[model samples]
Target: MISAPMLDHIVYAVPDLERGVNDIERQVRVRPVSGGTHAGGLTHNALLSLGAGSYLEIIAPVPGSEAPTGALPFGLETLTEPRLVTWAVAVDDIERRIEAARLAGYDPGERMAGGRDLPDGSRLTWQLAVRAEPAGDGIVPFLIHWLSEPHPSGTAPEGCQFVALRAEHPKPESVLRVLRALAVELDVNEGAAPRLIATLETPSGRVELS
Candidate 1:
């Protein structure tokens, strides 16, 4: 038997935030609201409520802002179009999850702290396990611990819910192993290249984002 973690949020990397907002609004019939800025000031995001427990995050570099070290997650530093990028799962015991990944032969990276300020001036603080290397081509999700902060999905733009979230890869079984370590599941198919696919129910009917 395999365990699956509860989803927290999914990321959509875009080149221009305003343009990304326009595109998402067109597809879902609702606009994403500004989600505040990263501590590094290199990136800012807008968000949409996908359901009760999860939301969609569209992140892009802050125009002329500089990233601290390497490229931003999901390739946002040089993103041309909006991409599904990656997802996050909520966890109560992040250290345990990281150890599980290590035992499974995958370094889930270190648990780090980060936060963003909401529009009303309230701050949201959380910790997450970032990957040491770009594994699974952004298909594998990072692990997040939101502490006691109110989840963004509750107050984000609503009217959408995920119908399906799946992926394809050359080695489905190997990828499945990593997902198992993270305690998350996604429908995986054998394909030439790695890809993430998600289906959503929106005001404009069903929309697919990947």
Candidate 2:
């Protein structure tokens, strides 16, 4: 099995929010809960618990909302279908982790504040390091530090268990180097393209999402 002790969440970007949630329910037999709108009102999300500290985020542009001037987060503007865009790893001290990554010859990007109001009127806040480098086009995860109590996974819809996560890349060695710099390990294999593949044990059965 792939070892991912720090896996926080995996981002599954879709073109439509509700449809994505419905499709997931059909497959997993568990409905996700609305996580509420993100900052800037550009997009909203629904979430599903994938175990203790990890969850799956289904994000898309807000219905009937105006698209931003630039490309939407996670390149949602151009997506024709739902796909696994990227993932995040939880960190205790984000700044210190950033410095450690930099010293190891990889910049995981700069820290940026991000928050979203829950459907219950409470708020969730966190900081994440957004990387400019492709980092294997989402295979190499960014770092995140949640500032709020009760992580999202605690309240998200349950029934799904995260089994494992792995990556396929054209240059496995290069991606391995970056993973080492980030101080994480994932089963890497040679493939035509780079993709992050996650396995889940759902109510229906075993399912794989990439």
For model 1, the local distance difference test gives: 0.83
lDDT of 2 by residue, 1-210 (tens): 254467899999999998999999998999999999985788899999998689999999886676657667788777899999999999999999999989998999999999997788888999999875558888888899999878989989889999999889999999899889988888889999988888999989999888
TM-score of 2: 0.95
Top TM-score prediction, candidate number: 2
lDDT of 1 by residue, 79-119 (tens): 77778888788888989999988987888889999799777
lDDT of 2: 0.88
Error of 1 at 156 (Å): 0.3
